[model samples]
Target: MKKSLPKYFRRFLLACAILLALFGLSRLYFRLTDDFRLSNITYKMPYRQAWEVPEMSEAQRENFNEILNQKFYYVGKGAQSYAFKSEDDKYILKFFKFKHLKPSFFVDLLPSVGAFKIYKEKQVERKNRLLNSVFDGYRLAYAIHGDETGLIYIHLNKSHELNKVVTVHDKIGLVRHIDLDEVPFILQEKAKTTRTVMTELMNNQDISMVQKRIKQIFDLYLLEYSKGIYDRDHGVMHNTGFVGDKPIHLDVGKLTEDDRIKSKEFYKPDLLRIVSKFNIWFKANYPQDYPTLKAFMDEQMQLIFEDERV
Candidate 1:
């Protein structure tokens, strides 16, 4: 029974309450209509088997088909794509995620004039550009570095082999049926990230093993550079991983081909970019071992830099 709030303050509070209610309702409307909107957004790209690897045996192809036949469980999502694990857990199917794929109330309310129209058109253009780039990257990665990148196939268009409705258990355990032929996706062999492996080794206090693994990672980068293939965003911890004893780049979206990368001008900067994050993490968590590893890495990198080809 305390004194009542001022009339202006009460009105402001009421206005806020009304705004919150409206916001919640709008969210509910979008959530309920998302699937319908997504269905109407069609993505069609040409089907091309431009390159094939003879090294990929018939058995491997058969195994890949078998995995596709089974149900997939959603794993996790990254900025670029949504990952779903095969039933056997040996492979992953990644579906590209697009921005601004659905109509928005606010955007529709605009009169479609001047800068607003330009902004809308640019957004659509960007979405298409991103989709094409990722598709090409997968194709290039398979052709140039399939084994290292673990890319088995790119299904960019509808195919009879993948023509069927399939079950998928999503991240929150919700079950949904997905039509494979209607969706474009990339199939890749799943592997543990470098950071995961390094953390384990560090926990075991196996400094020698950690050093060995880091050397392999460095060697992998050098090989890519020698081949004129470069990963522009080379975050070793997240983008590179271990497939058996070999280190491979997991994220192929940013890879590009340029012989200029092998030049002296690009060598040290590229190497430093790749190792920067790893160095920070090591220094923070394993300070006692950081100096030794840093010295070893520097020696190894220097040798690579001095190579005649480089």
Candidate 2:
């Protein structure tokens, strides 16, 4: 014979069952929504239960991991990172490898279950706060910021043309299109770096063209400077190249001071030296383009001087 449970006792048992069922469903939902590539990341590298790789599509992350394994030609290196041009040159993968995640702050504090609790509490913060800040600066550099692991994918230049489009994903998993001002700032490190720049490469075949563009870009910088922004990094000047007559600034990370920087001096003698060297090269190598190039330089200088006077 079964003993009948009291009414209050039955209610308590039923409530426990309902809560357990809801918890189970919530776990399942998390599993379903989670980006699967994160599992691959865990397998290849040490997993930080705190940080996660946002899921794009099912196979996108998997294919990206595979690309990392494949052989790629070395393109060049900026200050803090290396650039690898993919086999077909369809995309250039800029990778900044980071040290493995440290022991969580919770572990330092509690030495026991604190990491577990902190991980749960910070999961939302990691997903929301960290991602929000990165997405806001997507325009500063039109490259996708993967997790702290340090891999950035940039679209390759196809034609010498303006209005060329590139694809980058925002924090909310939507596609954002941007132009290739040779959009710079690929993999940004948290630490500060020396703002060292390379000297002029005399042996470069198109040195004359580069000089003209440099002078023009320098003028453009003055124009952009008036609006309260650093025009371009002095470091990657050599790497800057053209797509349909437009100069693409590659390294965008170098700053005058802080991210909200105020001013930097734009000197003329330094710029003139560059243009003069190029003038010699253009007359010797690219004579036909030299006349128009100087004309263009003169015109840009006119605009810059005019704006300065106003």
Candidate 3:
């Protein structure tokens, strides 16, 4: 017992040392990468010292206006973002809504930094320019007037042909799978309050289609997230849309939690949540086919609830 106590104490001290080192590095990164001085300014969140985006020049404003004035097809929205693409087929845009944030936002965001605390909130307006640039399909964002942050990406106008829509549900395999508009109402509103907005995404046909798309999504998801080059908030139905059969990411944000699925932590729980979504989705969309979906969903639910011992 005496020896064990000494060993445990050493392990605790080591853990503390690592945490302190990380804390120091995070602070350094925050101080060095702080772009408040370099970027333009916009309206701050409801109550905070100053978390804002850089100001857009007159030219950027004109581009913004040109895009806004024209009509476009709605892609979908994520927790705090809404997306659309122009009719002329040039780019896709995503708008991020930043709600409540603290002054130490940066310190609270960026992994090595305030990750110890949850104060960062959205950190939306943070230089997403650097972040979006790191990935191929991801486009950089710009601060519009003051309402929200805008992200513009190269548009792939393939899904434009999908006129018939079906909501795909993986609800415990009873019924089946199957598969929106407006700055548009979707099948469901994820969050009711202003803190988070509902998200929607475009997909073709039904459950089978989403299943096929899953393999592709997994491929791309593994590619980007594995390297830690991109902070994929973990993909979801609404966070991804189809452009001529290709999956496109609809939302952009930072996930600083080191223990997240894509991070060091196991990703199964996150994937299981999606599976559960399939259950609820199936129950809602295809009641007749739901019983058929039970076994498949049951297997998944088993992994989620029963397989933990493995």
Clashes of each: 0, 1, 33
Model 3, 1-310: lDDT tens per residue? 4445687899999999999999999888645432111011122323211222244477855665565444444444444433344556555543332222223455544563465344343444443433232222222212211111124322211123222222211112122111111111111111111101111221223545444554444444444444343334544545544444554443434422232445524555555555565556656765665665545555544543465531
Model 2 lDDT per residue over 1-310, tens place = 9999999999999999999999999888645533212221121222232222233364754555454444344444444334545444444544321111223334436533556667655653554443333323332333321221123433222223323333433222444343432332232212111111112223344546455655645654454344444423343234333333434444444322133322433444334444555456556755766786667665555564555521
The lDDT values for all models are 0.74, 0.41, 0.38
List candidate 3 segments past 4 Å from native.
1-41, 44-84, 95-207, 218-220, 229-235, 254-265, 291-310
Ranking by lDDT: 1, 2, 3
Top TM-score model: 1
| Model 2, total clashes | 1
Question: Which candidate number maximizes lDDT?
Answer: 1
- TM per prediction: 0.79, 0.34, 0.37
Which parts of model 2 have CA positions greater than 4 angstroms off? 1-71, 76-81, 95-227, 231-237, 243-246, 257-284, 287-291, 307-310
Rank by TM-score (best first): 1, 3, 2
Model 1 segments beyond 4 Å from truth? 1-61, 100-112, 307-310
Under the 3 Å rule for N, CA and C atoms, how many clashes does model 1 have?
0
lDDT of 3: 0.38
Error of 1 at 277 (Å): 2.4
State the TM-score for model 2.
0.34
